[model samples]
Target: MTATDPVLRALAHPLRLRMLTLMWPGPLSAAELSRELDVSHALASQHLRRLSAVGLVELAEERDRRGGRERRYRTVHGSPLSDRRDGTPLLAGTLAHNLRERAGRRAPDSEGVTVDGELWVDPQVWQDVRGRLAALAAELHAAARPPHSPGTVPVGIGVMAFALQEEARPEGDGRPNPAGSGPG
Candidate 1:
């Protein structure tokens, strides 16, 4: 998918992102999502419909309970970020929004840890690190929930790396070397 795809645009919102995360593990009905997210049933259904419109989610099942049919929604696996060429910016923006929200609610030492540092390494090393990080993220996404638990909390993990550029040189050279090296 391209950056301008409706799916990417639809997934860019905070509430929609939260819904997708909640549905990652399995199928969830609008009522279940509403309870989990503390939202109204109509609001949850609206967002689910939006997600379904973009093909990011699908109707997994429908069951009759209490004289009404409950519609369950599940994320369309292998479709969310399958086209990486256009997903980076969207994912980065989402990550930044999530980080900002989390930071506003708690201190750095409260519930989660944040790591930030700069590293200068060979291109191959950088690629290896990126691959490893991608694997870890996939593992986290596919992880199974613990059965018979009270409730589950959502966590965000992010990894970013990019090359630094060199400073520009003077156009017309009559000036002394910045490093104080003469024409030796």
Candidate 2:
């Protein structure tokens, strides 16, 4: 989650992000990921190894299954996007890709929140909102259940927020001026 080169590289793929989410609630073997994501077993194993190599996932268990050993991995649960923007650019593209995929699979009768924006706010207000966003994300992850559990509905959520640098304006306009804002 420190945004090291390997970690960023491993996360650049959209499928890896989805795999981490699937494994968040519980450990899952490569075969399970393949079945859930509709990818080949080899493809799932390749991505899982990349995730494991970066320490984003760890082997939680290994057991015999149909005469072969099955290894299950679980997410490490660090704040990948909150690691201080080291690889935010690359991660942003990955997020966009995954978001599109999720949107396609969205349940027709379900209402969901989807918003995006860029604006300036008071420093204290920004801080408060950021903390709340992080809390909500953690709560969702903690509430997650294994895939397709009865009485649980599948959901997709993506959030990204960061402070932007102020651009230099004319010397005469050095006074602080808030940027435009709208509901999102």
Candidate 1 stretches with Cα past 4 Å from truth are 1-3, 82-90, 103-111, 117-119, 146-154, 160-184
Question: How well does each candidate superpose onto the true structure, as a TM-score?
Answer: 0.73, 0.88
| Total backbone clashes of candidate 2, pairs 3 or more residues apart or in separate chains | 0
* Number of backbone-clashing residue pairs for each candidate, in the order shown: 0, 0
lDDT of 1 by residue, 1-184 (tens): 4348787778778778878877877889999988887899999999999999988898999999899999999888764654355657776788688778756756455566678877656779988987887787779888845222357554665455455554555655665544433451
What is candidate 2's lDDT per residue for 19-138, written digit by digit as tens? 999999999999999999999999999999999998999999999999989999999987765754778888989989989999999999899998888886789999999999999999
Query: How much lDDT does each candidate structure score?
Result: 0.74, 0.88
Q: Looking at model 2, which ten-residue stretch has the lowest summed lDDT? A: 175-184
Candidate of highest lDDT? 2
User: What is the C-alpha local distance difference test score of candidate 1?
Assistant: 0.74
